[model samples]
Structure formats: C-alpha cells, structure tokens
Target: MAKEIVCRDAGYDCDFMIRSENEEELIEVVQQHAQETHDTEMSQEDIRGAWKTV
Candidate 1:
C-alpha cells in the first residue's frame, strides 16, 4: 500500500499532501515541493523527521 505525509502534520500551514509507493519516494516529492513551493532547503533527515506515516 502507498504511504502519505501531509505538510500540515509537519507543522506547516500548507495543505500539501504527498502520496507514494514508499517513504523514500514520498520524501523525494516532499523535498521537491518544499524547495519549489516553500523555497526551503531541507535535508533528508529533516524530511524524515517531519514525516508522518499515513
């Protein structure tokens, strides 16, 4: 089953939700979204730390 993480759940005001086949993929997409939308630089550890498996 696919997993998901919501930006709000990560303490962000955005309602962005990333769903993927695995946590790695989900983190990748989230990282890209963070950079493109939020203009924030997040490391793998930051993404993983904020991730809420759903």
Candidate 2:
C-alpha cells in the first residue's frame, strides 16, 4: 500500500493533498506542495526526483 500526505500552510484555507505510491513520491509531493501551495521556491528536477512511484 502507498501513503498519502496532506499539507496545509498558514494563510491558506484549502488543503493540498498528495498521494504517493512510495516514499520517494511522497518527497516529491512535499516539495511540490511547498512550492505550489506554500509558495516556496523549488526546482522541477528536485520535485521529479522526489517521486517514488508513477
């Protein structure tokens, strides 16, 4: 089974949900979540590599 991580940041009411088939994917999701939802600066390659599964 895979794990899904739900993240929410200050100043935002909507919660960003991400599902990963593995740990690697979760990492990517976290980065994307931070960048897109949280407004944190992140790189595409870093996010891509963070994926654990397709």
Candidate 3:
C-alpha cells in the first residue's frame, strides 16, 4: 500500500500533502515541496522526524 504525510500534521502551516509507494519517495517529494514552496531545506532525518503518516 502507498503511504502519505500531511504537512499540517507535521507542524507546518501549509496544507502540503504527499503520497508515495515508499518512505524514501515520500520524503523526496516533501523535501522538494519544502524547498520550492517554503524556501526551506530539510535533511532526510529532519523530514522523517517531522512526518506524520496519513
């Protein structure tokens, strides 16, 4: 099954959400979103730490 994460649930104010076949892909999408939309940089560990599975 695919996994998902909600940005708000992870403490971000934005409503960014993503789904992927695996954790790595999810993290990649989240990282890209953060960079493009939020002007933020997150490491793999940081993203994983903040993620809330949905």
Candidate 4:
C-alpha cells in the first residue's frame, strides 16, 4: 500500500500531503517540505512516530 502523511497532522498550519509507492520516498519529501516551508528539520523516525501516518 502507498504511504501518506499530512503536514497539518504534525501541528503545522499548512496542509501538505504526499503519497508515494514507498515509505522512504514519502519521508524524504515530507522532510523537505517541512524544512522548506515550515523551517523545521525532522528525521524519518520522527515522522514515523509523530503520527499514525498510514
């Protein structure tokens, strides 16, 4: 199944979502979006544990 994560679920005021064939790629884009738009840096582990990103 493809993985999807929503930025708003992380407590950010923006609504950014990414759906990828693999979790690794999804995490990378999510991290990039966070850094570029939110000015926040997060690791893959952090993203996984932060929410029920399914």
TM-score winner: 4
- Model 2: residues >4 Å from true position, as ranges? 8-12, 40-54
Q: How does residue 19 of candidate 1 score in lDDT?
A: 72
What digit string (tens of lDDT, one per residue) describes model 1 on residues 1-54? Answer: 666778887677998987777777877888899999889988888877776555
CA lDDT of each prediction against the hidden true structure: 0.79, 0.59, 0.79, 0.77
Question: What is the lDDT, from 0 to 100, of the residue 32 in candidate 2?
Answer: 65
Off by over 4 Å in 3: 1-3
Instruction: List ranges where model 1 is wrong by over 4 Å.
Output: 1-3
Candidate 4 local lDDT, 1-54, one digit each (tens):
667777787777887887677777778888898899988899988877764434
Return the clash pairs for model 2, or none. 24-52, 25-51, 25-52
lDDT of 2 by residue, 1-54 (tens): 655544442334667667767666667667767877668864655555443342
RMSD of each: 1.8, 6.3, 2.0, 1.7
If the candidates were sorted by their TM-score against the true structure, best first, what order would they fall in?
4, 1, 3, 2
Report how far residue 50 has shifted in candidate 1, in Å.
Answer: 1.1
